[model samples]
Target chain A: MEKVVLGNHAVSYGVLVSRVQTISAYPITPQTLIVERLSEMVADGELDAIFTKVESEHSALASAIGSSSVGARAFTATSSQGLALMHEMIHWASGARLPIVLANVNRAMAPGWNIWTDQNDSLSCRDTGWMQIYCQNNQEVLDSIIMGYKVSEQVLLPTMVCLDAFVLSHTAENVDIPEVKLVDKYLPPYKLEIKMDIDDPHSFGALSSPENYMEFRYKMQEAMDKAEDIIIKEGKEFEKIFGRKYGMVEEYRTEGAEIILVATATIASTAKASIDSLRAKGINIGLLRLRVFRPFPVKDVVRVLLNKKKAIVIDRNISYGKSGIFFDEIKGAFYNIEGDKPKIFGYIAGLGGRDVTPEAISDMVDDAMRKDKPEKDIIWSGVKL
Target chain B: MIEILIHGRGGQGGVKASLSLASAAAKAGKHVQSFPEFGVERRGAPVKAFNRISDEPIVIRSKIYNPDHVVVLDPTLIQSINITEGLKKGGWIIINTDKNPGDFKEFCKNYKVATINAKEIALRNRLGSRAAPIVNTAILGAVIKVLKVSDKESLAIAIKEFVPVKREENVKAAYEAYDEVVFEGEV
Candidate 1:
């Protein structure tokens, strides 16, 4: 059924339809509504699940890890500081190979104190061994969460469905809530092959000797590598079940375009408008919306961007000392390519929830088109000098 | 595409009003999107929410900088906010006040203006306590009247879908405001 619902509520509905057996979450701005709605569903007997109210984000993820260890499908959500608090357990969940799915509303981290939209919080956890998928809208948030479980369980790696705080999290849109049976068909009841059973009684996450530890890390890396294929396969299967299909990277009118603008999260959605307006004016520009951040779709990124003369990467978060996180990653993706790489320019905008308008996006594209080579590695767009 | 900017104080149901409006438009088979601009969110703090209704899907995820229509649930917000700042020319400003549309002639000089005694209508329908009259639902009715985006019945259905409590009173307030809205001539 189609209903106009908040982006956060869409996440809850996705979790509900996925039939997540255990929900452990701590309330935080932007992400709070997701767990609140889930709690209401559980309280009203609408969804059959155990909603665990944990004291902190650490416990929230820890409880989810505990539930997943017992072979139960578990879910949790948080934002900003709460996500930072869960940093330790984040590794624990993935290291133990638990297929826990988490919804992280992307909020800017603070000593300055902010609760608005930014990608820093989620991007900071990039190396934590979790597969990350950033959503452009509420529909993607809902669809990706359902697909997240399918991908995670298949590869035994946890997944984080990240959406911008207040941007997509608070936005309401027409979302087609799939029938329970349809979701059940897409994501069957999760059955773990290796689970903590009292009868079997095998030690999990025990102390590994130096030689054994290297093998475990290698296995986890193998799983991460395997996840890329699973993500694509599940994406195709998702399209067959529901008419909506998603990919690791979405190319919008990139063919024969001189310049392509790359963005993720809601910023990518805005980039589409700039693409449309620029295209209407007969400017040869396109957009590449990166949907999946890790097991970063290197081949797909290379395929779409290699031939393009110039690519402008708009990043909402910064890596401080170096350059835009996405800019660095995309450049690294092209590092090993033999020859003729697109001249990629990175522009950091929308940090601390600053709005990235179509005008700013157009300016970035024009700037990239004008430059023979990046004068600087990263240009902070729209910031007062 | 019809872009709407809803201006109100926190606790005035500005976000809810936008959601109900979007839901009503969606019920009428139009693609709609609504979202609140996150701020302090404390009661009485100035808050704004946006709604977009269109024949095609809304791909733009940015805030509504230029609106086709503006709904001011709190008339007092006019003193503090340029509620019609980026409002397109010939855009409509629906204000919730007892004053005649003529009173806003100079302030709303370049756009079409509509007015309604939404507070009185809300009180008459017992939408909120007499002291704090919630005017968003009633203002939504004025929006429907000005834009003709949806009918009174569809809006009522949306209200029922959105507001689980005080359904009858809110629907009554909407209908009363719809019937009683006064439109100033377009400038």
Candidate 2:
């Protein structure tokens, strides 16, 4: 059914349709509405699940980890400070190879106490062995959560569905919620081959010697590598049922384009508008919306961007001494590519909920198109300094 | 595309009003998007919410700078906020004030101004407590009346969908404001 709902509520409905067995979450700004709606659903008997109200984010993910280890589909959500609190549990959940799905509303990290949108919260956890998928709108939030569960269960790796804090989380848009039977067919009951079983006792995350520890890390990497294909497969299956297709990366108007703008989350929507306006003026420009950040779609990124003359990456999070986190990733991805490649420009913008307007994006495009090579690797767009 | 900026206090349902307006536009077969500019969320803090209604899908997710219309849910907010900061030329400002349009002649110099005694309407309909009247729905009604984008019936359906309690009161308040809203030229 089509309903005008907030992006956070869409996450709740996604968890509902996925038939999550256990929900463990602590309230945080932006992300609070998601779990609040879930608790209401559980209390109203609309969703038959165990809603565990934990004291902190650490306990929240810990509870989800416990539930998933017991072979139940578990879900949780958190934002910037809350996610930072759950940092250790995040690695533990992934290291244990639990198929847990989490919705992280991306908020800016702060000493001055900001609760607005940024990518630092989720992107900072890149070293953790979890797959991350960013969403652009309310519909994508719902669809990606459903797909995150399917992909996570298949690959046995935790998944984080990230959306911009207020840009997507608090925004309301028309979303077509899938029927129960259809979603059931797409994401059936999760059955695990390895779980905490009383009948067959075995230690899951016991102490591993250095000789065996390397192999375990390798195996986790292997599973993350395997998730890319599973994510694509699940996305295709979801599209067949719901008529909305998703992928690790979405290429928009890239054909015969001279300049390409790379962005993720809600920023991609603004980039699309910039592309539309730029294209109208007879400029050869395109947009590459990076949906999935982990198990980074290296081959797809190379395939789409290898031929472009110039590419600019717009990142909402900074890596401090380094450039934007995504810009660093994209640059590192292209380092080993043989032959000529696009002159990649990295831009940092929209931090702490600063609006990345279409005009700013268009100016970035113009600057990128003019320069044959960037004087500096990273340019902080729209900042006064 | 028609962009609208709604100004209200934190607890006055500005965000809810924008959502209802977006929902009404969507129900009328137009694409719409609505979001609130969230700060340190607290009751009675100055808040702003935005809505975009268009025939085509809205691809720009930036904060509305040059809005085609502005809806002031609380008349007192006009004293503090530059409510007409980025209002487009020939745009309209629908305010929930008992004051006459001529009273805001300097403020309404660049835009069309419309007013409605929404607090009186909310009191008559008993939408909220007698001390704090819920004028969001009534202001929403004035917005629709000034813009003529969506009908009263469509907005009524949206109010029913969003307002959990006092649906009848909100719907009645909306229609009452729609009927009694005084435009600058009309007065």
Candidate 3:
């Protein structure tokens, strides 16, 4: 049934439909509503799961890791500071090869103290080996969780289903929740072959010496590398059941276009809106949204941008002194191209939830179309200073 | 697509109103989006929320700038802020006031002014205290009446399922405001 729900609550419902066995999380703004609804669902006897109330995000993930180690479907939700607090455990969750699914509401990191939306929080942990899928709306937010769990369990790596803090977490929209039975049929229960069992006792994360540490790291990378195909396969299966196409990147009107706008999360949605008007005005503009961040869709990115004349990337987060993180990735992805490739331009906007409007997106398209090449590495849009 | 910007003080259930309105529209099978612009974070402090209704899925995940209509949950906000800053001309400027809709005609010249004594209605239903009346439900009722985007049945069900307490009161208040709302000019 379809219902209007907050984006945070959508995550809870996704966890419910996925039939999660364990939920451990600490409360944080934007992310609080997710766990709040889950706890309510558990308390009300709707979802029969062990709701672990931990003191901090660190303990939260640690508890989830514990459950996953024992072959239970563990889940957690958190925001910026909470995610930052879980930084150490973030690496452990992936390195341990625990198929834990985490819902991270991407919130702006604070110095002046903020609780708004930004990509910096999730982008900061890009190297943690946790597969990340940035959502464009609440429906995607809900769908990604179910997909995350399936892909994570198959790949034996953790997944982070990310949505922008308030843009999605606080926003309410109609989301069609697949019946629990349908999701059950789509994603069968997982059983860890090599698990921590009392009868057949084993140690986890004991130590990795120089002889085998490199192999362990290489295997983790291999799992992440193989995840792209598994994600696509599972996403297709999810579409067969749920009637919504899921993929690493969604292309909107990119056929035979002179310039294409590239972004992720909610910014991509607004960019698509701008593309509509630009097309109406006889401008050949398009959009490409990078849905899956980790297991980076390098092949799909190359496939989509191979023919476009110019591609403009809009990032809502920065890498401090370096360029935008996604921009850097796209540049590196196109580095090996021998012949002509789209003149890629990196534009940063909407950091700290400043709002990347359709107008701003159209302006970027117009700016990119006008220039022979990007004047600077990072063209800051909407920055007052 | 229709965008409505709601202006209210904190603790006034402005965000809930937007959500309920969105729910009502969604119940009627229309696509909707609702969210709040959280600032200052204190009761009686000015706050903003938004709603977008469309026939197609809403892909513009940007803050509403040029709202097609405006809903003012607290009438006092009129003096302090530009409540109608980006409101489209000839749209409804729904305000919670005891005075008749004609009183706001001069103030909301281009837009049609919709007035409802939602505070009185909410107080009569005992939805909130006299000092802090919950005008969101009643305001949503007035919004439904002025916009014709949702029906009473949908609004009733939405309010019944949304409110934490006094569910019946909220439903009654919404229906009362639906019948009692006074607006200038034809909708």
* Candidate 3: clashing pairs of residues: none
Tell me the TM-score that candidate 2 gets on chain A alone: 0.99
* Candidate 3 per-residue C-alpha lDDT over B131-161 given as tens digits, one digit per residue, 9 for 90 to 100: 8888899888899999988999999899887
Best candidate according to DockQ: 1
Q: What's the lDDT for residue A206 in model 1?
A: 89
Which pairs clash in the backbone of model 1? none
Rank the candidate models, highest TM-score first. Answer: 3, 1, 2
Model 1 residue B123 CA deviation (Å) reads 2.0
**For each candidate, how many residue pairs have backbone atoms clashing (under 3 Å)?**
0, 0, 0
Per-candidate RMSD, Å: 1.5, 1.8, 1.3
Local distance difference test values of all predictions, in order: 0.90, 0.90, 0.91
Sort order, DockQ high to low: 1, 3, 2
Interface RMSD of 2: 0.9
lDDT of 3 by residue, A19-51 (tens): 999999689887888999999999999998999
Off by over 4 Å in 1: B184-187
Model 2 earns a TM-score of 0.96
lDDT of 2 by residue, B61-136 (tens): 9889999988888888888988898899878888888897778987676888888899999999887877799888
